[model samples]
Target: MRLPRSRRRSETRDVASDKSEATSQTSLPGDQQAAGAARRFLRTALAQWSDSGLPEAARLGERLLDDSTLLVSELVTNAVVHAGTTVELVCRLDTRESPPGLVVEVSDHHPTRALRDDSGVLDESDVPDDSREGGRGLQLVAALSDAWGISYRRDRKTVWCRFDLPAGDGATPLLSLRGEPPAELIAPVPPQADRANDQEWAGRGALSFLAEASDLLAGQLDEDNVASLAAQLLVPRIADWCAVWVYPAGAGARLPSVWHVEERRIDGLRSVLEKSPPAADKRPGARHIAWPATPGDTVGGGALAVPLLVTGRCQGTLLLGRAGPLGLPDEVTGLVEDFARRVALAMGAARQYARQAMISTVLQRGLLPPAVGRIPGIDHAVVYEPLAGDWVGGDFYDLFPAGDGRWCFALGDVCGNGPEAASLAGVARPVLRLLAREGYGVCDVLDRLNKALADEAAAALTGGTAAWEGGQARFLSLLYGEITPYAPERGAHCTLASAGHPLPLVLGSDGRVREAASPQILLGISETAQYTSESFDLSSGDSLLCVTDGVTERRRGQRQFDDDDGLATVFGDCTGLGAAGIAERIRHAVHAYDSAPPADDLAVLVLQAR
Candidate 1:
């Protein structure tokens, strides 16, 4: 099987010649459609190279090809979603190296939208929450590629990943072309070193440590979690030991988390820190604390304590200790202080959100009707589901007695969500009740409310007061009605006024559903907006249903839950059910239409003549 010397050298040269470089570039629009096109173009180009007798083609197995296509798809999709500009993709096969490599570079014109962490891999700490739908794209790219990185220019940014091809005979296998190995290939085990070295303080290692620390801090909202994560990030990275002390509002300081590279020495270190003298000023600042050069403590060079200041208040203190002769460097000190600042900010936000959520809950409960009171000869049921978050929604419903033998009910939706919407609902609910108690009819009550809202809006537009700035005025759709019991033969009569709200559905005892009133202009839009009342008779066992648009507009993927025909069908199915039964049926159906939590507030009111 031995070959001649000249023939062997000729074969080697042929293989090396095949390693010559080839590159292909294409520009695509920044949109969802471009992802598929970019994938197709990449596959086509790679196939052409395979057919050209390139030596690297033999190593392009199915797994590698599929991974390349997937990475291309993810990167293109990221560009489309985040950049929103023309994207340029350059794929290059560099046969110049022994094993050769394929470099895929995706560039966008948006420099400001560059990735937060230069490290291509996005770990759990980088994402805001576990339930987040997006942000896993970069993680996929890092997993599939042998190496990846981000580069920035003045007006553009490029994300590049490299895939190495297996070497041919007489060709040496090249290591990863990029300096850093893939994050997945790196072992999860912590470093064995008890102390950080000068080498670990430079370049990618230091930068990566800081980036990961930032991500961890950003992801956590709880003060205890933030403190623990902050301590964990400092230990085995910049310090031999770390301890965090938190000072809650109107409470004394407490140590929540302590970490040390040597697990056995953690208790001793904690004791030393606790017994140590307090800092000179004890105010919100950072400084170095001197420790005695004892036997076990000789290696522990010095300690630095930095205050966690949030909104000009000292919330906590972060203490760190390093080993060996080197005192903390200026750069390291600055990095530690920056980390403390991030922790403080996160803690502040978490506390503020909790406070706001509690306030909103209390206010919402106060604004809503406590219970649906029993009106003579009337049976009713109401359902309210607020949007999932730490804020109240704009939807509101109330049923109360107006006067003798009359019960007034209202269902309305403000134009927005959150605290502003809740405030407006608070004002509207009481105003409606006051007007009704003053003996105003349905039409008269709506007219007065509309005029009041319009005047407020006009005053806000004219800068009448600072309190009326921004969201002082808002639009709302309302369905207001008063029910009065007649005689045993007639049952009850309902007088209703519709102000741009969804038409009320009247479910007849014989299984027919019809609109109770026509729509009108929404309140607060026009000063001259006219509203009129319509009268309807509710026979025994007949139910009137009023709802906010949240019920009708609920979506399953791309399709809505209830159009006109669908609503009618839903009503038709509830023919023999009582008011409470019918409301439950509709609520359950709306929830079943989509697996995801509803994005809007839902409110439903069902009143039946008994």
Candidate 2:
């Protein structure tokens, strides 16, 4: 959405020490951004007036500038919203008095259009009803100016407001907004000739504009926002109105984002453009195009359109419109074309990111088991959540049968995030499953998987050494185990190893907790790294917990979830809980540790002897 409208005033006549009128005038393109353009023009005039050093000119206070700018924004907005025509803005300071007074006036094409109520009508009188959304801008104008009123001629309507300048020391206004102006001033004076607007986009200003556009556009991961920002940056700067039409590949759906200097005319403009889209012109640069005038249109009907070319293909069009019989100047067309190129690049990047994320999501589903296999002698529950933005995160877990009377379980975290880390975890799991099914014990399964990951890392590094140290290492930390029911009355036999993972915890029926396995160096750090298994018996009413560091390393400010054996304490309290209940309890506690969502991937697996 566009930013909320600022309260501002009209422009008029000013006086200096020599009794010469000091004035600044410009013609606004009557689109939605006319208010913003008007505010900038008023600011320049005030700055010049302050620097002119006429009598009492040194006393231009912050309040005076703020009130004047807000007044101009309001009046210009009213004109653009309702009149839908070019706006004439004039600012003048009467510098002869003790504290100079500034006069401002904004004129529009619709001289006879009266205000309506909330249903979007303008009020005919000075006091608008409490609920006129259309007239609120004008109401704000009335409140900020010392004296303000409308001057209607046969051809133009002008809103003039006067502000008694404040002292630099910040004195209050001499008079409040007293509804209508003097009767003599209310009568229509001589009409004015529209001043030509001078636009120069070649220096620091253009650089700043493009720089700001880059910053805003680059952060947008959605193409719609990119189109919206492009339109906003164009209007009332180089073009009076703009439309970015994006065509989704293979879908034939045309999404057009339209913006105009006049907010009220946006719907009309959009409807017209959608009915008549530009040709799918793949040629580079920009050229004039035929744009049909909508109903009640008065200004800015001429148009120019450029292709939104990304890479070598044309995906859409960027069309901009302006006033006058002749179209935009060559420099403006060139500038807009350059701006459109940047917009195209941003859109391309967004689409690429979305495509990758989608692929990652699809691959994530394929990489993990559809459902954990049920073991005959154990009740188990598992909770797995990847980081929000990472479709394929670093954390993963699996529980599946290893043939015979054996069951294998593994939970692991790769060194970093994104695709590289995810690829490593993908390779590690399959190797572990293959080794376990081949009748390898827990330590042997770990050893074989470690070598496979190391080989993959070496192959990747041999291809390119420059990025090997750039978070591309395939090092892994894993907690792997195998279980067998040796006796029905007693508990199951558990063989497990912790390869730099969070030490697994065993909870006794009496609420006592202790580490199940000792820590070993992370796998894939070196192929020579060896592992050892810890064998134990879990009697009835005993539960074992296996977790990736994502659970143990969860942070709230400076403290981690496992800073002081936090996970062990929580596990010890789940003495009587079933496997599912214990998993949910720990998941809830981790999430509740901080108001924000967990920043890292998390996986929890619990096994209770049946």
Candidate 3:
């Protein structure tokens, strides 16, 4: 099949002409098709440029081909999908002294236009699972391309992309249109000619963007902050225009709820659902619909609704949409879902704080005794820590001024925790304070409290025999103390009463520690239970420390407690630290002894003779 010389040259010229024509034809497509074709064509063009060996452009050609082509595709895509029209793409093979690359621009006829909003475009609810048909296109382009956007004109809009192709001796581009680019855009010089540096550069850039996004999300604190973070992450990363809403854990199927929004209106977005809510419900708290917008109409276009959910519960929904069909990618959707969970946790914390504040107010007012009856030379400071649980625990301390110059005080822990225990303390506190002021000793006060509790228990179950037998019975442990400050000639005397409770620690001015004298039966155990009170003399600078089981019984391991020995070590090792210091040491010791933070309410009362 030998041919004549003329025919052979003609064949060679035809082949060359065909390749040139193919390359030229790659540049001429409608905007939509051009963007897609550009991506496909660029990948192919990179391979061809590498093999065909334009040694100079080929030396830096791979890098230029990858970055320039990707940016070209993005600009073309944005111009086609968002700004509207078949764009004009211009790519100049730029070669100057320093290095070489490409300059690309895609222009469409649209002057007055809108930009992607700062919020995300993926509807929280419209995220598709891994086995789905679409998503993640523009997001990928945003990740890969260096810069992409649209420019305005009197008769048209020009979408443009600029890729700073790095300068590597083997494959990086140093400069193209002008001289050397700034240091930031300059590519690193290649270490080896055989190595493919451009692919590595692209990979590193993508990874850097992802790392930045991860760091941004890691530092968030509250639920609202999470939504805001999601919005921040999604906006240029995905499409634009995002909104997120979260429901309280118990807010299912309820209106007048809390929600977060980036944009308030998506005309017809709401009406579509209002007109057909049941149909929307089929997707389980999510719905998506898109319709083209006619000129002058606010409704229609791209729209998506997604649910913020955890454990199969619909906590809230996310609404995202744009005027055109900008695909909602799964990566963006997954990000929003993750942010939704954090938002839920943050809201839960806020709710707990509000609850704690309310209970604190009610319990503090209801439980502490009225002002001391003008007792002389007696000062008091009380501290109470509630268990970190559903309700505040029953721990109370009080100093009542009994008309003389002496003050009577008591500190006690009710058995169990929560409102029931707190209620018992509420009933017993004022009564015991009044009885002590009326000249009753510790034993008499105990007797009065026990009888009153029994009577109240009986009254609480007025319904039936069953209610009286099991429902209305409650028991408690208590400790009470009183002090009489003495003048210089007299040592102040102190008295304490314990019932089925830990001994209170007493620190003498001479650096000695001792337990309260005697212990007795807990309140509500035996109606006729006898109580004993121990008296000790307090010198100037001497102090008494009273506490509940919360300090001693804090669990450190599976079956370990910071027991009496631990408490003794804390009090005995006291190093001239005053009352406040001793209290602080005990608190610190408890914190250290426990494997985790102490879980129960802790109450401490300290008295130092002036």
Tell me the alpha-carbon RMSD of every candidate: 11.2, 17.3, 20.5
lDDT of 2: 0.73
Q: lDDT of each prediction vs. the true structure?
A: 0.73, 0.73, 0.55
**Local error of candidate 1 at residue 367 (angstroms):** 2.8
Locate the minimum summed-lDDT window of 10 residues in model 2: 181-190
Error of 3 at 121 (Å): 46
TM-score of each: 0.68, 0.63, 0.49
lDDT of 3 at 522: 75
Winner on lDDT between 2 and 3 is 2
lDDT of 3 at 321: 51
Error of 1 at 466 (Å): 14
Query: Tens digit of lDDT per residue, candidate 2, span 1-610?
Result: 1111243322222212124258788999988666656765766666566567654545655456556766776677678877899999978765554445777888998887455566533454744443654335556665566666566677888877777766554432222211121110111111122112223333213433453465567778988888987887776556667889887787653755888777788888788777776666778988886666754576446788889898778878888876544345465566678888999999999889889888998878766776866677789999989888876888888888988888889899888887777877787778888888888999888888878767766877788763254566668899999988765646899999999898999998888998899989888777888899999999887999998877888899999999888998888888799999999999998998889899899899999987
Candidate 1's residue-wise lDDT over 181-299, tens digit each?
A: 12212212244342344343432234334433554566666778888877877776567778888777777667778888777878877776676534323366568976553236554
TM value for model 1: 0.68
Query: How many pairs in model 3 have backbone atoms within 3 A of each other, for residues 3 or more apart or on separate chains, i.e. clashes?
Result: 11
| Candidate 1: regions farther than 4 A off | 1-104, 109-199, 260-286, 290-302, 322-330, 373-376, 461-473, 485-491, 556-559, 595-597
lDDT preference between candidates 1 and 3, better one: 1
**Candidate 3 on 328-348: residue-level lDDT in tens?**
444444444454454444444
Put the candidates in TM-score order, highest first.
1, 2, 3
